[model samples]
Target: MAARPEPMTPTGGRLAIIAGGGRLPHHVAEAAREAGEDPFIIPLTGEADGDWTGFDHEPLFVGDFAGVTRAFRARGVDRVVLSGGVRRRPDWRGIRPTIPFLFRMPRVVSTLLKGGDDTVLKMVIDLIESAGARVVGVQDILPSLLAETGPIGAVSPDDAALADIRAASEAATALGRLDIGQGAIAVGGRVVALEGPEGTDAMLARVAGLKAEGRISARRRGVLVKLCKPQQDVRADLPSVGPATIENAHAAGLAGVVVEAGRALVLDRRAVIGTADRLGLFLAGIERETMA
Candidate 1:
């Protein structure tokens, strides 16, 4: 077995969480607090959950680039974590760019218009780092959330399901290589669905529709595969799944879900496992080499 990477040590400085959406930001905050590091949350308005009352938090719009930088400097934050989801692109008209943003405005605009999601994310990371704060991956603070290799829950994929897993994985990786999306579904060794901008849930919903329409054989189940994009910056935007994912896969009549071990986040793992078990669905985490 390959050795797990060492957990990152807390910086001991105030940690700022650039909250987006979903339960991930909350998980990261709890993990940071448990590590004895003070956590300050800077939630992106509309995207972030409003349950961050106890922590030192401020709600700021995602377009407010100036405000975010100022918050980090004012709060004495040295380390930052960008967590959760942000489905909508920021409206540029609403933003009040800081001097740094202004200085890099040309490059930023060019990247936003011409580059893919990964390029845009890399630019965002560059912007944050240029502002004198270190951006850390969510896995660094919440290593336990990293999906473990092999099968999870009571159900395991059968040989046919495994074949579908491999097929779906190849499709998903091909999509990732193009910086398109991170998920794909396969039935009976044939690709059935590919995730687009609508995301995994929506992709599964489409598969469910196909299954209902008799396009897919009701007796033959499939697998959903999600993994990091090839050449993706691992420090941000790793693929994730939770209880809802399992429920959706079950609804779509998928036999299992496969993720990249040590590279994907398993949100609410206990609940996810329980749901998978109850639904008789397998959740497997395969190593990157297997996918390769």
Candidate 2:
């Protein structure tokens, strides 16, 4: 990890976490609270950790786009961090919209119908910014989370692992195009586990269990794919992994990590790499088409 810039004096006061889903949001909120800045949490309803007792302040839950904005506004939070995302698509069935959401239908539908993740996320960013709130990516708040440059394992790929890494990277992008998920674990050219709403850790646990049961090999020949959705809204739900992933792979007795070269975030890169290196795990930032 690069030397963290001395945290710019908390930009006045509290840190607002526009948390969606996954462990990263919880991690970020806890960090913000420990920094002496009260964290204003806005959980994405079914998508976030609504029981956020770790944070210094209360949390508000919003199930829709309109509600999300208003709840953040209510907190009087001008600075915010976009951490993680809810994995499931909204169940719009039987759901009624608020008047404002109804009024903004044209703009919202126009973007959703005509755009990909990037377009939609950019629109959300604009919406939040217009509310006198500055929406920032997790990087803006935690530079220490990004991975550093270099191979992270004690034993670099001895050819076989490299081959699996290449294959998994390609496969991940193919899966991503369908918005299936951002990660998968494979063994000897076969897909062993695909990440679901349970996220990476659960997937890792399952694969490890399979290995223990003699269903797969526990060696460098294993494959891991961390990728971005083909139609990603980079400003929002881009794929990210950190030291916990490395720790997971190690516990699972896996071989390597293959993340989308430019589009993925290797959160806590230095520590992740160091841990991977210590475990003899191979790490590769691979190109999609090339792997495909």
Candidate 3:
């Protein structure tokens, strides 16, 4: 295990977590509290988990940009973290843009119309920073969530599995460069599936269907490769996997899962490892150079 960095001191004022769905935001809030900061949360409606009720949180629609900014300013928050999954874009018609949101409206509209996910995220980060708050990566508050390079379970990938890993990694990276998606699957050195906007679990489920339909040879299993998009701003939207990912991979009949070391989030690390071990699936994290 790597030595963990000391928790950041709370000198920059209270942290504001703009939370979406999944366990990550809850984890971030808990970690922040451990670090002596009472983090406030702005949970997006229909996206955030209910676990946030114990924290200082207000539920708002994802499109409520003005409301989020006003809440942060009112709470005297100066540092921010964006965490978790937002699978859907907000309904634009219902949004009532605040003055600050209006100032950035043109650029936001342009990005929404022309740019990809990464571009939209970069603009959102800019919007938050424009409100005079510093945006930090979730890993900054919870370093242990960052995956280290190496095998992480009882089973390790063999030579064949490693080849699949390499092929899948390259394919995933290429897709990422186009800002399309962050995951791909390779079986016997052949690309089997590429993740689209549906996300990783859905991609894996598709792979399972392929296997059931005999589209993928039953004799050959694959590895799922997930990485941070090459052009992605690492401070937000890092690729993440958890125990559920392991379950999905096993169901897909995959031999293992691979991720970029130090750039991906591994949530519930212990549970993820335990699940992989029980299912006889390998989980490895490799350096970017290894994929090249």
lDDT of each: 0.88, 0.66, 0.88
Residues 1-292, candidate 3, lDDT per residue (tens digit)? Answer: 3333456678768899999999999999999999899999998888887676678888889878778778988999899999999987655576657786887777777777788888888988888888889999988899888888899878999998999999999999999999999999999999999999899999999999999999998788899999989989988999898999999999999999998888888999999999999999999888888768
TM-score preference between candidates 1 and 2, better one? 1
- Give per-residue CA lDDT, model 2, range 1-292, as digits (tens): 2233434347664567777766778767766666676778777666675577755444444325556556556666778777776564333342244565566667766775565454566666776676578876665555445443335445566567666666666667677676656887767767778876577889998988988888887653577788777776654665676777877887788777767655566765667778778777777665565666
Pairwise lDDT winner, candidates 1 and 2: 1
**Least well predicted 10-residue stretch by lDDT in candidate 1:** 1-10
Q: Model 1 reaches what TM-score against the true structure?
A: 0.96
Residue 141, candidate 3: Cα error in Å is: 0.5
lDDT of 2 at 284: 62
| Pairs clashing within candidate 1 | none
lDDT of 1 by residue, 51-141 (tens): 8888999999876778888888898888889999988766556667887678887777777777777888888888888778999899989
- Listed in order, each prediction's TM-score against the native is 0.96, 0.68, 0.96
Clashing pairs in 2: 117-233, 118-233, 145-267, 145-268, 146-269, 147-269, 152-277, 153-277, 154-277
